[model samples]
Target: MNHDGHAKNSRTAYTHLLWWFLFAQGGVIAAILVPIHVLVQGILGPLGIVRVVDRHYDTWIRIVGNPIVKLYLLVLIAVPFFHFAHRLRYLLVDLGVPAARSVPAQVIFYGGAVVITAVTIWVLLTTVPISFG
Candidate 1:
């Protein structure tokens, strides 16, 4: 293979594809898991079909104390947020906003997702005391 500028451009496109692949993964995760979460936690639980008991502080703390549950909550919050950012970015572009398809738009959209993920992680770590003992 010749070392050429075209090859470099191809590599850049490949990298962009990888980023889109991650965005698609976030979208799929949100589409599949969030609806069930909302159905159970939002609609069904509220309707009394799932029977959500009001636990005291210690019991709630223990529930979040589990490592797996903490990770799940992080994914549940963060992935959907990326999906929202992706969709919102495209929506702005489609609505014909000036510079909506520019690099700064991408930064603003995905950066918002990153910020949300950080906040989610901070909240989870502060709230959940996971112990291996």
Candidate 2:
């Protein structure tokens, strides 16, 4: 009965709510954290403008091997990834791509996010610290 002629879309409210929640949380976290991350990691640390713990490979390795830091890094990378996927999906729809709302589009966008998140976790898990013994 809806505009798609698909009987009001069988997708439940909770799924929509989940995506919206991730999108909103991702946006806020990205806006607050991404800029600082870029400034510190991308610019200052590499350029030697600031001496951060991550400036040295040894220190960086030690820091990243910590579970807490790994979790933080996952949040830093994964949250905005979902946010971007949702935003891009809607952007395509708004740009008159009628197929953007289709099941394939959902699979492509959200599935991509899921894949990337899994890869990030795998990489983080594989980061074994080198013992100085």
Candidate 3:
């Protein structure tokens, strides 16, 4: 039926849009984080003539423990988890699961991802101690 065909087309379009949106989001994060990470690890720390690993370890922990940085980390973790869940759903479909099966699998996968992300964000925000000293 034309209605059925249209519904399928709409679903396909939505799926494609979701993929592109997530992909672009990830690309933007990578563009920002990669350069910052490299600069901190490669250029600035080394220019200071300090051991890179020691500097990186200390700096990374401090950055992760900072409130603003932790917030960014939460966003980073959450987006990647959602992206992973979506990709896993497609993998399930490719493995020959029926669409009905795949839908529920996707739901459960994302639900778990959300719960984990929440817990991680909470722990990052609370468990880590911050000092201006």
Which RMSD values do the candidates have, in order?
A: 3.6, 4.1, 6.0
Per-candidate local distance difference test: 0.77, 0.85, 0.67
Pairs of residues clashing in candidate 3: none
Model 2 regions lying over 4 Å from their true place: 1-12, 129-133
Question: Which residues of candidate 3, in runs, are more than 4 Å off?
Answer: 1-60, 99-101, 131-133
* Residue lDDT tens for model 2, 48-129: 9988887778788888877778888899998888899988998999999979899999899989988999998998888755
Candidate order by decreasing TM-score: 2, 1, 3
What is the C-alpha local distance difference test score of candidate 2? 0.85
The global Cα lDDT (0 to 1) of model 1 is 0.77
Give each model's clash number.
Answer: 0, 0, 0
| Steric clash pairs (candidate 1) | none
- Model 1 worst lDDT window (10 residues): 51-60
Tens-digit lDDT track for model 1 on 1-133?
3377676655656756766776887888888888877777678877777664222466667777778888988888887777788788889878888687788998998889889999989998987578542
For residue 116, what is the lDDT in candidate 2? Answer: 90
Compose the digit string of candidate 3's lDDT tens values, residues 64-101.
66777667767766666666666667787788866825
Candidate no. 1 TM-score: 0.80
TM-score to true structure, per model: 0.80, 0.82, 0.55
Better of 1 and 3 by TM-score: 1
